[model samples]
Target: MTKVKVENLTKIFGKKQQQQVALQMVKEKKSKTDIVKETGATVGVYDVNFDVKEGEIFVIMGLSGSGKSTLIRLINRIIEPTSGDIYIDGQDIAKLDKEELREVRRHKMSMVFQNFGLFPHRTILENTEYGLEIRGVEKEERQQRAEKALENSGLLTFKDQYPDQLSGGMQQRVGLARALANDPEILLMDEAFSALDPLIRREMQDELIELQDKVKKTIIFITHDLNEALRIGDRIALMKDGQIMQIGTGEEILTNPANDYVREFVEDVDRSKVLTAQNIMVPAITTNLDIDGPNVALQRMRSEEVSMLVAVNKKRELLGTITADAAAEARKNKQTLHDVLDKNIITVEKDMLISDIFPLIYDSPTPLAVVDNEDNDRLLGVVIRGSVIEALAETTDENEVMDNE
Candidate 1:
């Protein structure tokens, strides 16, 4: 479901008359520079249209002055749009009156800012419950909720401490905890991690990714860093000069840029960081362990022209792997394939980054099995060493290589 949608969203910063003139200029397809020069109005976000799906991290990214921050503010009507519709669950938030918008902000949306917004005087728990406190939730109940949120972020022990006592990263966690305490439907994270040190930023990024597995809120994250966007965004909208340059997955944008600007914007990204095992894995050649005996497994390896086969049950749950030597030994001994199955085969989660898969694939004697760790270790695909190298080199299709060994 689309949790939030923006259609032709435009925000102009100027006097009323200037804004009106700029709006007309925009309707005339006037360029951002032309509109500014003609009407003395700055177009903050230009005709932006995008929908954020439910339970996704939709990142809006660009360099400074790219209007990414302005675009995010427009979504919640913080900076009122000059013209356009901001729909949250189909309700036109841009059209909502002050009190109506307040209710929506209070109940549905919570924003975490670049600065760790916390009170110096208040305890972490007190700061966290601040949102619920304003909503007139019972004190005891709000405290409980706040504590749980803090606990989820692994900061419950520090709940009694003031914000000043916590490190920058810990303070940010408190900020995140405070946002979650409200149980909002949408999280607007505007450069939330940029203020942190590099190492801390990455840790927070990993924590956010991990937290999303549990909360699954519609997250509209704004960032200036392309790497940060690719690492966390389910899909990314790359913006420039208050206009969107392109919107796509990291791989799509990297491999097939929409324009020259986007191409240059992502030209230097490390492909290994953007590509995951699932992006390069081929369909796994398998032998059904429950049904395929040693001879049947051998025949599959012969026909497939491979030395091994991934073993799986009827349900396609990964069992192990069987090498030609192991298969042949089982055949000579008149034993089932399972009797000689190599259950020690290395398996990688489908979402593992190619960078992380490199050492494991090259160092291993067999291709790594890509399994869905969340799905009972169900076999998804296989990632061979050649596939990993070819993916980094950008010379082969993701699912093109099926030469499993």
Candidate 2:
């Protein structure tokens, strides 16, 4: 379902005369006035539209002053829009009165800024609990929730320390915990990790992904960094001069550039990191033998020393996987491995995260498995982690050429 919708949104700054001053310069071929007017009546955002899916991390990216930040601010009503409708969960919030808007901000959404925004006088626990406290949550309930948020954000150990006592990365986690403690459905982030060191930023990005895996809240993240957008966003919305130039998945934007602007943005992307198991898995194989007995399956397991065995129907298409225990159970029951084998499987479809393989890397004696798309369950290929890492290394080398060029 669409969690948020922005339609024909535009935000223009300055007064009427400032706009005219700029327009008049164009007619007279006046360089000085043209520059003045363009700067004076700048359009922060113009006629933009898009929808954010529930539980999606939708990113808005552009160069500074490209209206990326302004667009984000408008969605949250941090700044009133020049004109357009902003909808959250099918309700048009643009026309909401102050009290209604405040309610929305308090209950439905929470934000994290570029700076940590921690309170100097409060300890980390107090800082994290501030939002819940403001919403009039019971002190005990809010404190317990804050502790969980802090633990998830990796700030539990520092809960008793002041913000100044922790590193920048730790403080940002506090900021995240504070935002998360409200149990919001949508998270609005404005360059939330940009102020950190590169290594710290990378760590925070990974942490954000982990959090998303667990919670799946809809997120609207604003940034000027293309790499950051690709790493964290489920879908990216690239903006230029107050307009969205393109919106698509990271791989889509990388493999099929929408225009020169987007092409330039992704010119140096390392493709392998963006690729998933579906891109390289082998075709599924089928075999028909009445070895459904547990003794036969145990023999196969001992012979192969495999962690799991794939079970298929007559066509060799995937049905599910069975582990060693099932084979033993089948033997005890005087049944074939086929009889006791499980057909339900937790397989990755193409476009699944490369990181998804982390669990599977050490999961079986065989390094390869049938790949499927998580969205459609369509088979893709068989993949091994070694090949993925090699592909990433090759992509890194390829990216270096563009950097030097």
Candidate 3:
């Protein structure tokens, strides 16, 4: 389900005739600077469209003056769109009157800001309860909810501490806890972590990712940092001037840019930091140890044109690997594959970064097994050296060997 949908949304800042002229220019697909110079009007956002799915972290990223901030504000009607539709749960938010819109703002969504917008005079628990209080939740119930939210954020012990006493990161946690206390369906974050020190910002990002796994809220996060966007966003929209340049998964946008502007925009990004094992892993060729004899394993190897085959049981668990030499030896000696299987295989999680994988793949003699640790160590795929290098060099080939390229 789509939690939010923005269609042809536009926001222009200027007088009446000038705005009309600018909207026409926008429809004519005029450049933002040209429109501003011609009509004496500024186009803050122009015909932007995207959807945020349920339980997604959808990021809008760009440089300083891109319409990312304006676009986010337009979603909740903080900034009225000149012409377009904003849909949340199939209702057109742009057409709602003040009371209807106010109700939606109170119950359906919450926004977290960059400056850690906590009340200086209130204690952390009181800050967390602020939204619920405004909604007229009874004191006892609101207190319980607020405490629970704080506990979820690992800040319950600091409930009595005032905002000034907490560190910047802790204060930001209170801000997040406060938004979550409302139990809203959508979260709108605009550069929420940009103020913190680098290390603390990273910690906050990790915490947010972990928190989203538990709460499953639909989040639209805005930021100027590409690395931050790639790390957290399920999908990203890259913007420039007043329009979106491209919208895709980080890997998609990095490896296959939509246009020249997008290609130039992402040229400087470190691909190793964004590419993961899943981006480069190819399907594993395997042999079943419980059923397959040595000849079966050798036949599979020969068919796949590989020196080895990963060995597993029916459950697809990562058992071991069987080399061509071992399989041939087993066939000549009349032995089973289980008797000659090598269990010392290197394994990595599917999400492990290519930067971290380089050394592991560089030193290992064989390919790395991409396994799901939480899922009974199930074999997901195999990550070969060529695939990793190709991925970092801005290519996405899911085949295992360099010779395949």
Scored by lDDT, the top model is 3
**Residue-wise lDDT of candidate 2 within 1-405, one digit each (tens)?**
999999988776767766455445533544433445465776667679999999999999989867899998999899888778999999999999999999999999999999998889999999999999988999999999999999988789889999999999989989999999998999999999999999999999999999989878999999888889989999999988777889998888877889998988887766766767765565443223343555555566677766556665443456566677876776677766566656555566566656566566546455455544343444344566676676666677877888789
* Clashing pairs in model 3, backbone N/Cα/C closer than 3 A: none
lDDT of 3 by residue, 1-405 (tens): 998999999999999899999989988988888998999999999889999899999999999889899999999999999999999999999999999999999999999999987889999999999999999999999999999999989999999999999999989999999999999999999999999999999999999999999999999999999889999999999999889999999989988999998887776677788878988899999998989999999888889899999998989999999999999999999999988999999999988999899999997888999999999999999999998877665533222233365
> Model 2 misses residue 293 by how many Å?
19
- Full-model lDDT for every candidate: 0.91, 0.79, 0.92
Estimate TM-scores for all models.
Answer: 0.88, 0.75, 0.90
Give the per-residue lDDT of model 1 (tens digit) for 330-351: 9999999889988988999977
Q: Candidate 1's error at 28, in angstroms?
A: 7.1
Ranking by TM-score: 3, 1, 2
On TM-score, the stronger of 1 and 2 is: 1
Provide the clashing-pair count of each candidate structure: 0, 19, 0
Residue 206 lDDT in candidate 1: 97
lDDT of 2 at 211: 92
Clashing pairs in 1: none
Q: Cα deviation in Å at residue 50, candidate 2?
A: 0.8
